[model samples]
Target: MASSIRDELLKVLIEHQPHFLSGEEISRRVGCSRAAIWKHIEELRHEGYEIEAKPRNGYRLVYRPDRVAPEELAPHLQTKRFGRHIRYEYSTPSTQTLAHQWAREGAPEGAVVIAEEQVQGKGRMGRTWHSPPQTGVWMSLILRPPISLAEASQLTLLASVGVQQGIKRVTGLPIQIKWPNDLLIHGKKVCGILTELRGEQDQIHYMIIGIGINVNTTSEHWPEELKKIATSLAIESGGHLHRATLIAAILKELEEVYQEYLNSGFRVIKSKWEQAAGMLGKTITARTPQGLITGVAERLNESGALLIRTDQGVIPVYSADIDWKEI
Candidate 1:
């Protein structure tokens, strides 16, 4: 019936876990009629939560589906503001587009927009992100950082570090951050971060940081062209993963690092980012607007630009497509 009642009922069921909760006890705790409780329980089952009902025993939570919905993530989420307000869509053109719309409409900082699948998922350099249904994490986060417009791009680096740490915490995978906005595992792409902002000369109004992660995807999920370059946590870890748990972990890690970036500066985040960086000290080629330049990857500047030491000199690349095949 009502969302509040459904939430309460689910909360009670989840809190009790394998132990059964009687109908009368659940009704009292959720402040709903037994009939309503039954209706919602059926609904939960329909949504993929397994509930076992015995003759005398009322119900026990058996299993929960791998979903990134607010209710599903509530148990694993620990951030104070990040993910506090979520807009979940079963299917959308793009979470980034929705997040930008919400941010423009004054949505609070830390509001997240998640989609099970993105028909027109956005990616770096005007590319499209592959987001199959129930396969990956396709979501965007709204932030109102106090940083200036020129410094807004740094959030991409910060988010990359946060997401890599979160994934490592969950699966113990050696997720590494490629320069700019890509995450790799076993030298294959697993995640991408895109940070877009609305700001003036010196101030930022808001920002939408879109994060796409390949969690449970497999060989069949990838197109022939992408199979060689893309990968998933399940593929790398040799097991399936719960998408909600990974989302919660990413949100918690992002919020923690974001707060630190605000309190101190980019120095702390920059250092952490370097540790997880995958391209440093390697020979890589960057396709900038000017032309293709190949060189030894040096380090990132304070502004989040990648510095490559070419035969000519050290060049700071603001935006480009990285080709690390040389590495």
Candidate 2:
């Protein structure tokens, strides 16, 4: 109820952008009391909205900060289902953890969990992701696909492709995929995707895809170890980007590609993934559970495994950390 009122209040203000709306008029439009309107306006101001208030003129929205709140993301979203139901948080332990709990409680597909800052962000293989406040996108999407577990693993690759397309659409940067789920910009890491699933036997339950992107994070924000390997859109684009705009674009693109995957199949998505994937046909080494394998990078097989042309023979790697020496 409070969220609805806030949304309604923001709607009124946006509708009257660059123009002052009297307190009474805004209260009437939002179906709230004048006192409530003033409180909400003050809250918005605290959230980085610049509202100029005058004794006679009422209030005018002067500036809007690049926040990923629902109000900021709604206008930019073009997807039919994705982001329709968003669980936004100012700070959280991990969006992925919350998404899992939500999925267990029957959260609908296309529902998303977004956080401004993640105190305990997760990465692939139980690693900790570096997530700072207000400078990146930390969100988890819920998906319920009626597919086999083998096919379910393919979604990670699909996510990489979807995120790559979205980043390109928003930033116009030359982004590339590093195998299964990492996005690289100018050979530096900019984004990481972690796709988890829950199921029993042949049946499936739901999947949570956590996506973390460094949008406007500056070089100084990174620790010493990450400074050489990590990067953000602002660093590469030479300007800060609006987090909400990028989030909306990603949700749209991800939804489109997801629908395409369900309708057509993984063939098309695989082709797209390979095209955007970096280091194909290059010499690389992967650390697999069995052991380390060094081989020439080959194309992905039908099952979405990274096939490597080793000296012995061609082997399909299901999961591994690829070391792209050149990249």
Candidate 3:
């Protein structure tokens, strides 16, 4: 993918950090005119880069923005595919909705849509997700993996494990998975994953994998009833976690784990998911579309279904609102 001229200009500035290069030097390096270089510098300033211009000295990056925008994450991203193309915003109703629309418009695979705040975010069962401004990782990724629709739920499991790994790597906090979607720390919810699909029955078009992690959120940020249930990386670790770093780590881990799955099948991912699940012998009630069912949460079956051993016998739960009410 070809970068915009402004991006090329920003690259030059970042490459010469801590020392200002002349306008003529920048133009020579980027193969653009002095006027074009000045135009790009103004655009970079608008993108939140602190560039200083001197009479003879060129631009130098004093500080970079704390945003998850393409320019912000481009320097930090290590994954070859994920987040290579991004659409970033300050506020939106939902990144997942925007990502789906972008996919329909022929956005490339691994395209990502991220927002600093989500006003109408939702999770499984269409439950509202609290996403205040600049407090969490609210993003969606588009995947065009070579997997069948029957294997869709596995993507959720893969992402859940990826997030757990990423959070652990960044904060050293041991987070656990609560079955299909929720991530728990000290028995409180910290993250959620929502995976949606598109395309014909067999021919896949795209998959939208949405992950929302409460990074810098504090206890006071939660409402009264949610105080005991929802927590954050900052709350768990007692320090502020960089949302961009976590996002990069998540995309990297997700791509790596997913690549492994693509080559070796679901065995490895399923095993990791089970170990991170932390709910094998426990019993709980889950609210499904049919009704509430109580059973001992046994283990993940082959297809990533939650196998609950009830009195009637073992049954596979494909989707549910896991009762975290007591947690």
Better of 1 and 2 by TM-score: 1
Rank by TM-score (best first): 1, 2, 3
lDDT digits (tens) for residues 280-318 of candidate 2: 999999999999999998899999999999989999999
The collision pairs in model 1 are none
The digit string of per-residue lDDT tens for model 3 on 1-327 reads 225667677767766788989888887877888998887777778877788888877678898776776666765678989999999989999999999999999999888999999999978767889987889999999999898888888988998988789888888888889988789988899998898889796767899998888988887777788897899998889887767778888889988998999999998999999888867777888888899888988888899999898999998898787764334
Q: What is the C-alpha lDDT profile of model 1 across 178-198, one tens digit per residue?
A: 888799987899999998888
lDDT for predicted candidate 3 compared with the true structure: 0.85
Candidate 2: where are CA atoms >4 Å away?
19-36, 54-58
Candidate 3: clashing pairs of residues? 21-58
How many clashing residue pairs, candidate 1?
0
Q: Which portions of model 1 miss their true places by more than 4 Å?
A: none
Model 2, TM vs. native: 0.93
RMSD of 3: 2.8
Worst lDDT window (10 residues) for model 1?
A: 318-327
